[model samples]
Target: MVFRRGSSQSWPGLGGGSGYTASLGMLRAAVLLVSLPWGAQGAACANVSMALGHRGPLPGGRYLSIGDGSVVEFEFPEKSEGIIVISSQYPGQSNGSGANPMLRVTSLDTEVLTIKNVSAITWGNRGGFVVSIHSGLPGQAPLHIQLMDPHETPPVLIEERRDFCIKVLPAEEAPATRGADQVHFSENPILYLLLPLIFVNKCSFGCKVELEVLKGLLQRPQPMLLGLLGQFLVMPFYAFLMAKVFMLPKVLALGLIITCSSPGGGGSYLFSLLLGGDVTLAISMTFISTVAATCLLPLSSAVYSHLLSIHETLHVPISKILGSLLFVAIPIAAGVLIKSKLPKLSQLLLQVIKPFSFVLLLGGLFLAYRMGVFILADVRLPIVLVGLTVPLVGLLVGYCLAICLKLPVAQRRTVSIEVGVQNSLLALAMLQLSLRRLQADYASQAPFIVALSGTSEMLALVIGHFIYSSLCPVP
Candidate 1:
């Protein structure tokens, strides 16, 4: 329904009391043009009778237009150069029950002018504004125009309340202010999760398993060849193929290379026990693989970098790798030695420290989660898709490699898990150290989408452990 105040169908202008009551203020030569953010065109205009001038007689009533809305024209004696403002209001218009009229200039041949801040009565007012129009012709017909709400009775103004006409002029110049906002990207969050995922889990797990098999195999040349094939050939090839298939980014591919290069995980013995694999074999292989990884990881990184178009030197820190080995290996070797000499004390110590590894891993994962998402966002989609596909491929490649080497079924399963799962934590630590040294802006975004890649791997490990236990139930 349409509503307005101070009008009867045949009452003419008699309902409106005086000329001052009906008079719209005239525009003087002293014109001020204000530029609004909404207008791009060079026009300065405002609604003259847009605001409530005074209250009207009728409060709430509806009517339909008898004809096209009345057009009150203003004569600009000079060439008036400015935008035109058009407005409509009903006196005693409260509870915001009146429709905002669609206003336009018939003279300018333009569509209806839009009014801003004319929504519900806020601060007890509804006002609308628009920018200026340049070069308004001299002796123009109407200085102001009002289009009645098409939904209401037309004739523009209610015959009772006073109507208005305004004259506006142009500003000297327009300013260079347009579209100054913020910059955004699509994949920023994904990059944050990549490094930790690639370096921590995959690198660590694979290194441990490969080394375990290598230790026993390396006692003779035949098995040593098998170990070499598993580490360098099968693993690298699988990674490369997965990257290609998944279309990973160069950075993500580089991350995968780093994972493939890192040596054995420190927790192979515990992981083996949990997964029902051979603990002794896992430890021995872990030792052998850790030693070999310092060299192999660098080589693999270099090759993968070249293939992925990454420009880094792909230099694995042998000294750091050795340092890690010493830190981890010395304590374990000492513990084993002490166990042989004093069984009860050694057993007690083992029990006491058994929880330490898990505690450390938990802390590591937490830190990684906080930092990893930032890196993952920078990771490209190609790299992410490729990285996701790698685990499944690694599993298949591991089984094939084991079969080719004539390994027993149980050993093959162990090797396959080892190959598929890696100690990405180690690689991530090294990457962090490297990033620190390089002083690059190496971060992704917040609220990372896949920052829990580490956690996912942990869940996968649990799944693997349960599956293995079910497959090979204890006698």
Candidate 2:
């Protein structure tokens, strides 16, 4: 039952040859000498054809015309099973009495498709085989079929077919008839619970935004413009480049691109505050970038998805975008009003806002860890490596761009943190809303990993900055 690749050993006992090698020349010569046509050799086993279940033969015989190149493809839905019937016109010739040729089928990519059972049929000198194929993940792999002479000490491949391929398509999803305003949170219960808390944290941070600082930035808008350019322009391109450089799969690449295309995360202002950056600029940039995402997110996603050859109609959740904006805007407006009207209450909220944000951060990390254990269980090393590098690249690009524009040091730090920390939750929501369950869950790994990486890296930088400041007090 052992199959060897590139073995030049002869296939003995064919065409009256005592020890005939199964080389192309010898096989062709035997066909000519025995008056057996190439298609009829191996008792017509060479003229192979396949079909799904009991259906008619596929269009190109053994060479299916389903996809390009030498491979012919047949697709099976994920987590489903199907029968592939492989038949030849004539029965395989027996080496001796009551001996039938052995049929072996193997799936080259077992992760995508599994060959459960291979059943052979031989009656009245007519032979064929049926293969039961089970689908796994959404992917494609070559299926190898071998008609071997079992009479030999070791099975010798009589007629081999490698052109047939199996593709596991993503499971079909029922059309979503839900209205734009309606939201579904059926994917992950933990994430569903955490969403409200996350938005609440964002609202709390909005309370800390200083209106005077925002007014000054509006008067001189270079820092704000620079932050937008880094957040929307540079980060998406960096993500696309990284996806290509790492040769990530289409779904993973799309996930990374979507995450990068998103706006600044809710935590950016906190990071800026802790790291001696301009907190007002951080909050302003976050708000502006989020509003910009209404148009820019879909544009960037479309460009990159087209490049990745993904044809799925990815619908950007406009309601979600508008909701995010409302969450940010209303809270900030209320806070500004409170600051102007209830000065004492505003002062109290500002004093406790930093500690409240820290608590929310710890809660988010705990929730992310719980979800990461599920989403990232099978995450590959390349993706983890790429995810780790993405935020760092954004930080470097934003910092360099700020320096080029001659922004103040505090503004540079604010821009860097804003650009580097993406709103991965928005990306996650988009994916979950747009794609099927399995695909959405699978692609979600990118955002989750990126979120964890950015948080950890920014925290490390904040700690380092704190230590340096403590050691060398600035008088």
Candidate 3:
């Protein structure tokens, strides 16, 4: 997985983007029309409703009026699939007054389902729905929604209206096969800079134990925040400048920017431990930088996209973005809570998990390596340039930022390790889900970069740890 810098604004929200509001409106509208009463002439109807969880409260009802004999079209969200429930109360029809109403549902204007004597029932929840129409002929429109009630003599027709807004989610495209022709690979090889992210969290948690042991000997503690900001914000620009200095191709240049810009990974704790540096500071920096990253990463990507002349914009999936906070931040906070509740248990779990986290991390690397082997062969000169730059810059910038922030020699060692590591594994997952082009454009190179990136991070940790340990022995 490669990094795309300054692409955060390209995300739907953040800078006054409308994508969030538009999505919410569609969701609200779908929930509003689940149940409505129709007048005597209202046997036929037009409406939409989403699935509610079993035994959960029903969503609010949406009301829309249609005229008899008029054609009504209902459009469901794109990729929506499931049973749509339809029930009606005729005008002047009192509750519990038995005037049995019947409705039919269908697809392609063909009668597919019939409901006699409507009963209360609800379906699934949280996502899209499958549409079935009853009554009126299916029109030329993309959605297959039509509702009609059987009435005496001339059954009144519901108006087919066009004012309702229904959104169609685009079909997920398969990955692209033209290797060199893909934009992410050939034009900008910068995407491969996300290597260290693969093991950041597990490594940091493991490393934090050591840091907590040595928290008191330091001359100052709070100033570590400045080092973290420098690590995340300052380093990327340095990477960008160096990439340009080397006259790297657009692909390689973009890759360098992404690598430097990414926040420090949890792995920094291990690297700190290896270096015999301040493990506590490393863990704290990792957590702080990651939280900051949710906002900075997207925004930085947005800005970098514009600056680097990368025309293809990427969006941050709001759900995934939100999930990251809960996944990383919440769990760490919970660990702290656990510590507060039962210090012994928390410590025991941390020690047990810390080693296990390493094993798991290694297993993850092994899996990534096996999967990424095919993509490895596809790395061209540009991709290689990115792979090479990340570690080199990570080391240089990691140390430089530590010094600039005036981190004490020992904490500087910790900051250096923290600055260089990243959660590339998570980034890879997001890339695969969010960007189909990653598969299409660089299928061959993508996996290789991922593997290479992870390997590079591991090496950085090893090297940084050894150097720091030699410089500062544990007192």
Candidate 4:
């Protein structure tokens, strides 16, 4: 993954940018929304939350200020997802309501959700409410949300809307969210310099690969069927299903799609070694999946297009594909030459590098976390659950497939590991590159959350296997 410098304005409400939200008015309101943390629509003031020693409970979200009573109307296309936060007082205030606030959200004269007098559920702002929504069909005009007094006459307080207003934008124009503020990403120099090491660490493991084990793959290709089916068919669909079930934002859902569609991670061999699986099979599967990814990745992505709820096709980066091939080939080739020329050195290198791969894997994770701390923190529970389950299910399916084929125990373990640990690095790389070409900020977040969860789950599997191996007595 590549990293670069970034700059951003801090959002007003929520702390971390976790999921997605409709961004129809995001860019415009960010300027004033954060500042006016309290008051009715069309009102303005300074940011009061900054003085609370930064230990703020305010979930990051767009904030709007209204004078006494006013209505804020949002005009956008269909399939939008977002959050509308109505704060009765400044975010920093720990007690009571900010002048008894009330709001009624509507779309096309129909009330979709309501925010009345804040209850204890509103935390400190006892009279405020934070609500999320998914918009309806595509219409020529916009949908409207009104803020009014519970004791008012027409229920429509003011005829005007202001800069700090919150509106749910269309899905494509907005992001799917889990009731959190939009994340602010600022680049880290440490991330940029160390990110490429992830690929190098992965390739180092490939250096120990054996060409003889690959010959079996060439001769009997039946075992390859399970890996192919699981990568192409089962995983991607599972991610889609999880996204839908959880009502996840569009971008995060798509991120899960890309990750599930990806091939086995480069760490498959290490996992196989840790679990006493067939290292040869692990390496072969990783290589084959990486090679086939050029065609299947896009195809898998297209297969779920209708469900994506997106109008534009994401551009696949050719350079990332070629880079995957190059990284895989060069290190293995060097390792092969080293083994052929100096057998003793090869043994020593393997002993040193085998465990080193795991260390580098987590080190890269640290780099990634430092690079996009808020993005990782912004990941919601649904995405996390799906990410963990996808690989675990892949492992079980792979093991079942291997058993049906009458494969040996070693091969079974290898296939299981290979199927479970997808090449999250490549998926992340593609997501970072593809998202730059798209208009949605949440899209970038989707893949990232999947990557984080996927990687963590794989590590958990490895550790669980280690504990199991230690407890079981050898024959």
Candidate 5:
């Protein structure tokens, strides 16, 4: 009896035309005779072996490490396209005839690596086949190889399958020293010219901050505690949750987490001043959070990276954090000194501080927009959606927490602004310092989007508040 592929007919002897009962009896006797000997010798069948190029048999329970975008070949000493050759010799008998076993290769995760371009090749008298594997992102994926009985109707499994893991490592930057020098800047020279002016504006804003209000905050530290909790704890977890929910790519997710883990931005106090919130509380929270971030940022990133199954060494910019601290603290301290000692000079700074802040804000937005045009050219919708929503969500979370803690309305607004805004530049610095060029560029989108989103949203809120205040006079 013979069975052919794509034929709708059963084996000739097993057909149901006539004499089916007699044929069935004969088949049962034949199976009974063949089953006993087949089961006993099945264990002795020679299993096919596979090896990565020159690596020798994939090291039994070890993964092959390949850099992203690199190609690796798997070699098998059997000339079967989708088949494996197996030989079983009986006792006191010559070598058995080669059995053509079907071979199947599959990647557990195509995003990490892929198997393709399977072709046969000559390996002396015994022919062979090679499989080309292409690595994608930095992650681990299992490659499954199976041998099956090609003669079977549905191709039954011949024996246990072979599993090999491929670990794709991140592409390493060739010129490590030059990587630090590859700093990106806006094309417009005006942006560069405005940098010092922005710092001057920050100093001016510092002069306007009431020393008494800042002193009052130090005495009552509840708002500071709430801001820290929201900034470090709630924000990092929220970023992680959003990443998981939206299924962001690993690098992008890491970027988002790092951005969320950053300290409250310098812009928070500016927003507070614009919206009639507690500027002292905002400034104090920003400074305190920046200081606390030295420890808490690394902790938060480590915990969440582990959750995301990312094992790369994340570079946290401790120096950058300290520099930001100094940049903020020194200016504010100098301004406070001027305010206490030279009241006339302090009044001059206070008069121009608002205009300076407005000008700085416009300059920042212009620069950010220019940078975003380049960074977010290929940005995904999920990232944009997340970017738009994260600031709003953080604001709501902080406000609700403040309300629950029975804080004053001004302090609540301050906490909300502090929590919503993040130091995206710090996050960008970390990513650029840690990852390779391609990866750094790709990951940086999260920070850029978040920064732009937070700034734009806060500005809109400030304008709305201004309009409302103008319309409804305070009694």
Candidate 6:
């Protein structure tokens, strides 16, 4: 049974499905190329009667031909903003019953991306988009592409509307198609739920501080620098090297780098207390790392993405990182500022921040784990090895670095745990915000693996510390 406008071919539906009773518009150059964010609406033009064929349509296979339910390949025209206009017939020749054709746009790359385009962004000359559409019911689709505050999705307009008799030529499976547009939100549908959980987790972080704790940091800039070394230098460098040594895939390697580059965990101070380490140093490391990550996150990402060849252009999520920094810094800063200005209020807030943070941390972890189960399923074994070993190595190298510098034993333990227990929550949040939702889910494979590993390994270390304390009775 072929799909109709309100058909039973049920795709894993993504929200907006309303359309207008539109006029016929031209394909290609006639439609306006405006830039807009995802979910932002625009108009469509339904004017042109484009005869989209494999080769016959627009001189040299430039327009997509919907040739009678087969695979059609089209070359994206130069000077176009990632938009490929196709038409079946004129408006008067449309099947007014409104049973629109269905099409799937797959990129030339290995991954199967469900390409959904709102509009495109163009440079003076940047041509790298190659894709194919599997469209049914061939001829010209007389869709009038117009600018609407509320427009039907751009990608499927020519094919979906029933009015045009499309002339699309279907292509067989090509190995490497072109790349453009945001990927489908197919894999991790639960990512929508995970995002808000991330926000709440960050909000609770405000309570994790005191003015006295922050002021103590200036006294030992040396130790703080060591912590930074353990964080920025040892952890990220180690993750990248490990990925190379293990021969991990590009995306997976990026994930590992992200996790290792992340700041000390919000839970670092608690972990230090359990391990008989310096809690104040742990708190200070968390503060500095979180605040400083505004720069480090993007910088480190640029370095690793280039080395790994993840993308050609720099699409780092600048605003998202800034938002994250604000969330982390403001809460801690407010708590510290309030402590000096109003000690009683400060004390009460910390008291609340400490306990609820743990509870929220647990709940958030559970939700994140549910969302990430699919990602972990796709991960191969070498990445698992990287995640498991990297944090443990951080613990070893951090302790060793501190010992070499002759920091007190307590500070050494604190540095070790701080370095070892990555702020995976921050990493996860960054993964979601910095990249497109689909990109985030794919890239998060290594970080989530590291996170799960961190959870288990940290538990083991804490248990060992308790046993050691019972036996040796540290005086």
Judging by TM-score against the true structure, name the best candidate. Answer: 5
lDDT of 4: 0.56
lDDT of 3 by residue, 284-334 (tens): 666667667677776776676577655444544446445554555555555
Model 1 lDDT-worst window of ten: 2-11
Q: Looking at candidate 5, what is the lDDT of residue 8?
A: 18
- Name model 5 segments beyond 4 Å from true: 1-109, 116-134, 138-183, 186-192
Worst 10 residues of 3 by lDDT: 6-15
In terms of lDDT, which candidate is stronger, 3 or 6?
6
Per-model clash counts, in order, read: 50, 1, 51, 27, 2, 53
lDDT of 5 by residue, 1-475 (tens): 1112111111111112224433453344334334323321121121122211223222333222221112333222111112222221111111123333434556665556555433222221222233344556656756665544545788786443334455555554454443332335424466568767767767776787787787888888999999999999999989999998888987899999999999768788888888878877887898899999999998998998898777778888989889888878888888888888888988898888777777677768767767656567789999899989889998998899899999999999989888999999889888888876667878899999999998888878877887998999789
Each model's Cα RMSD = 20.7, 10.1, 19.9, 15.0, 12.4, 16.6
Q: After superposition, how far is residue 165 of candidate 2 from its true place, in Å?
A: 8.6
Off by over 4 Å in 1: 1-227, 349-363, 377-382, 429-455, 463-473
**Residues 1-475 of candidate 4: C-alpha lDDT, one tens digit per residue:** 1111121111122221222222322332344344332332222222212211123233333333322223444333334433344444433332332223344433331122222211111332222334333333332222243445433554445222233333323334332452233333323455456546654554445555677877877898766667888787888888888888887655566777887788857667777876778766776777788778888998887767666644445666668777767776677666677778878867776776656767866865665555445455545677667766777787898888889989989888887777777776666666666653232334555555555555677677778877887899587
Candidates' TM-scores? 0.47, 0.68, 0.48, 0.61, 0.73, 0.53
What is the C-alpha lDDT profile of model 2 across 26-138, one tens digit per residue? 34333332443222223222222322122333344432221122235665667665555455432333223545565667777665677766554332333345455566767
Q: For candidate 1, write residues 63-130 as lDDT tens digits.
A: 11111114333322222334443222433322234443333322321111111111111113322222
Identify the superior model by lDDT, candidate 3 or candidate 5. 5
Candidate closer to the true structure by lDDT (higher is better), 2 or 5: 2
Q: What TM-score does candidate 1 reach?
A: 0.47
Give the least accurate 10-residue stretch of model 4, judged by summed lDDT.
1-10
Candidate 4 vs. true structure, TM-score: 0.61
Candidate 1 or 3, higher TM-score? Answer: 3
